[model samples]
Target: MTELGKRIVNILQKKSSWESDKERLLKEIQQMEDLDILQDVWTRYERVQKNPDISGTRNDPNSLLAYYLDITKEKPEEEFKNEKRRTYGRDGWPDIDMDFCDDRRHEIVNFLVGKYGRSRVASIGTVQTLKSKAELRRVIKALDPEKSINYTAKKPDQSGNFALQNEILGTLPKILKKRDGTLLKNLQEVYNEFNEFAAYMRKYPQVFETAKRMEGNISSSGIHPGGIILSPVDLSTLCPLHTTRGTNEDGQAGASKAMVTQFTMQDVESLGLIKIDVLGVSTLTTIDFATKLVKNNYGIDIDLSDLPLDDPLVLELYNSGKTDGIFQCEEAGMKQALQQIQINSFDDLMLAVAMYRPGPKDYIPQIAKRKQNPNLVQYAHPIVEKHTKSTYGIIVYQESAMHIFVELAGLTPTEGYTFIKGAAKKKPELFMSMKARFIKGASKISNKQVAESVWRQMEPFQGYAFCAGHSYAYAYLSWKTAYLKAHYPVEFICARLTEKSRRRKTDIVYKYEQDAIKNFGITIHPADLNRSKLTYIKIGEKDLLRPLLIKDVGDKAAEEIIRCQPFDPDDLLYSFGMKVGGAVNTKIVEVLASAKMFGNIPKPKVLSIFEAIKAGRQKSKGRQTGNLKKGIKGTVKRRKKTLDLDF
Candidate 1:
């Protein structure tokens, strides 16, 4: 067996408490001559050890043997299917699965705290600084010293009696501008204008000097949303720590506090401390909830990791531009790009992901055209062909740039990486020096003319590029979400609604509801007192909108109302006021009644019933207090409630 295989087998043996049969299986694996077969067996063994319940062979000896033999029976390509690449950087966090729910992300931080001790793990801090606009506004305010300042200038006209009057401050770059003029392009231009007002401002150079000093200066410190630093020793030993107050989803400060580093992420890295980003991704939470709903409603236990890459329904959805909720593809621009590209494969999806950025977005039409007519595609040179063939003779990734430098110019991997980085930064000196070295090296292999032509073709990509590996990881997630939405539309929509509702993103929730109903033929049932849950739920064939979505009905009210089921108007008012202890109130009843939540009763009738209940309760309380004052203490039987009030 290979060294990796041996280590895996040893670990599995220790984990599974090896028996005689396992030992024999390990010996069989070790004796195998074919490395491919050995690797397959080791992978299956590892999977079995990690999750025995999902494995075909949990504890049965014959089943385990059959499973190993079955995987090896196929050809090498079929036996070892290449999974989509998940890229990781210098940090330890896995980039692919970092999009966890907020609570789960916090739970992970808490887990690290429990493992490493609280004093060793803390969140990283960030410095907020002034930007160009703010700096300009401040400088202008300081220089003018007026809330609203208007300055006018006159230009000699053909008829000198009526000269053209131009408002300088009122018609400045932001406030207004001449349609044909590019004079006031930016604040710097305003400060350098040749006009008299600008010359007047030049007298007060201190204002500009003060603004320049304040610009880019640290304004305040805040916690990095996802970056967490863990040290081997107490974090205080490395950097200063301060307690920062945290806000809830509504932006209100809460009692929760977090220990944050005085140094930012870059400073922490310079100190050699480990910083990992624990990002919160609502899509992962959506997927989790969708899977549960699918299993609960359809009895299909989906394993998102093992989904097929080429599902016709999913491909159809992508081709049709129905990717409203797919990860990274939900943006309107990305959706339009998908429709234009007419994706037929996962590779097309990866290309779309990489090419949808600001700089690369200009190349989308060319890419789509080439994809439509493969005959139009051509490579610059033979070496270029090798690296650019995957992207149809176009540079779509940074890796492609590196490969081109390494293959055509004969640059070392380190040198190639440096060349790409320098090109990306637009460092003219570094780029020219590297260009000379590349041409010289290429002359040794081919002609310098061919190398120059290739370099010209790669120039545009230097501005912006995506790593193909990261794009593939994103494409993998996009494909999974697309697959789930295409197959289980109802469950996916319900999960999506629940997710957006929890985040209080009413617009997104409403959009999903409209799309589900209009596009997918899914019915949305209104929040019913007896039926709706606290969150959107999938009934037999329809989705029940959450009661919390109703205006004036808070989450606590919805939960209590859902808990106390089968309520008439009387019970609802009693529960709101007395039974559930004011968890639901008059406002909630009025909103629910307006939403047609109280059976067949109208809002007017529901209000009247609520008023009657209030009056009866008041009278009963007064009588009880009066009787107690007269020393006539006896139990009074309360009236049984019913929903029989006239409009």
Candidate 2:
């Protein structure tokens, strides 16, 4: 054994109370050595087949090694072990999905690129395919070269008749999603099922033929939002590579600079490459900003990781349906679900997150009813009850489904995962094979009728069951945001507004402003020359001074305005014009003036001030200007007519 392996074994020996645990740790350590990870096991790892690798599958929340390695927050002995079994040395690599603060997620990506050479890591690519609607539109535009049919115009086409193209495109039926969560019923299915669509297709035979041929064709290629493939060797040897400004990890409307693989994520995985998702969650950024605001506003440094999961104030906020700034609970339906479930604890929050999806959503009221009266809860078998008791006898999570498969059907953890994946991905052959295995094994433990009964019970919602670990993470984030908003309302809302402002989502920022003033008794101050910073900053307990709220005033202009503070108190207007003249133009000054940034100066007056500044500077430089007052008035009048002062 390596020195590091021996040290880890020794540490486990001291902490483990049972000899069996010591034996298990020693075996795992040996496995790590065989996998060539003993020397450097601090990094998160998942062993691949006998091949040397360092990527891993879902972590066992109750595993001693997982906890000891600091890979998971839940302790080894935590009561809720909803995570699936960690299958080391599995046949294939499992993609690792991780979330980070959106504002700083690039730091992690950069770190990965540096640690692993840039040649070894690259973002995965995705082929943008044409859907049914897009295909129909493309076919319509191509067939109508003479412009007889207008697709976008509300009026008739050039022939002065109703546009048949609009009717044909509009007749395309919506996709019918199957129970397995796959869109099995797409364009072809629409034609088979809907007579109106079929008739339309039959009428336009050429268009239908072309649309069908073009459907699902590659329209373009783009980098995957968050999938990065890591290889032991240079990635170019395995697949094609290209440089791209990859899509943002935060799911926002932006991209980042990175090296991207020409192959898609699935294609890379099929080539035995490991893919990891490093998603940028904007909520994490909001939480970080809120915590810093708390430190600055209240002198209290909030350690978010160390927060108690069961804060009553947080629960009260959920129960009251006041989840305006809380993550994941902002949707109206989710707020109603919180009230219906009467979520009063952390576990309940997690359950709400898991059961809020489509397949399981129908059971929310039933789960709530069962929660009120535990006697009403019923299970298919003792095994099902054992795994699903926390969720009130409903298989609300994929982990619970896996647990049932392990105990009732005697399947290995890996086999159970495969079964769940087959069902979720709508692989009929794989799902049937696993179902047969499950029944054969379950029949040995129990009767055939009971085995079939259990399968029937799980079949309806098993495809939509969420990952327990994912739901828990989301619920924890929700709780943290709620806690901050509940205890530090002003700071949290200010942080939210600041983030929205940075994104240039002015409408949503104004909506939040109304919510704050109306609901939280907080006062929002407009951009003040003396009090405002580059972003929103808190004044007193209840007041928040906004950054520059003028249109066309971006970060650079705002920075210049903030830098030139106390703008010539003696000659305020002309001095203001002189200081911010270079960064902002006359239109920007008009907008800022209308926002009252320059105190009661109207937009026309602000324009006149800028004109005066220009004229005086020209005169001092020995430039003769005839009719200077007339020139300033004409400039101000013309600017006033064109100024967009609708902040």
List, residue by residue over 1-647, the lDDT tens digit for candidate 2. Answer: 88878777666667645475666666667765665645434454321112221222133343456555545444433433423434543456644676667676676576677778879988888889988777777777678634576668887455522265567656643655444446643578767755787898887788788888888889999877778778899888999987765466522213564678888877898998777787777777788788888887679988665678778888889998778878888878888999999987888998998878776778899989999999999887899998788889888777778878878988788788777776666566766677788899899998789899888877764457577766767787788899999999998999898888888888878888988998889999888765577678888879998987456787777788888886766566755655664777676777787788777767675676676656555544543445544554455456554532211
What alpha-carbon RMSD in Å does predicted model 1 have with respect to the real structure? 10.1
Query: Where does model 2 exceed 4 Å of error?
Result: 1-4, 7-41, 44-85, 88-91, 145-163, 173-184, 245-257, 569-571, 618-647
Q: What is the C-alpha lDDT of each candidate?
A: 0.64, 0.72
Find the 10 residues in a row with the least total lDDT in model 1: 77-86
Positional deviation of residue 368's Cα in model 1 after best superposition, in angstroms: 0.7
Shift in Å, residue 64, candidate 2: 6.1
Lowest lDDT 10-mer window, candidate 2? Answer: 47-56
Off by over 4 Å in 1: 1-97, 139-144, 147-209, 247-255, 423-433, 569-578, 599-647
Q: How accurate is candidate 1 locally (lDDT)?
A: 0.64
TM values, all candidates: 0.74, 0.85
User: How high a TM-score does candidate 2 get?
Assistant: 0.85
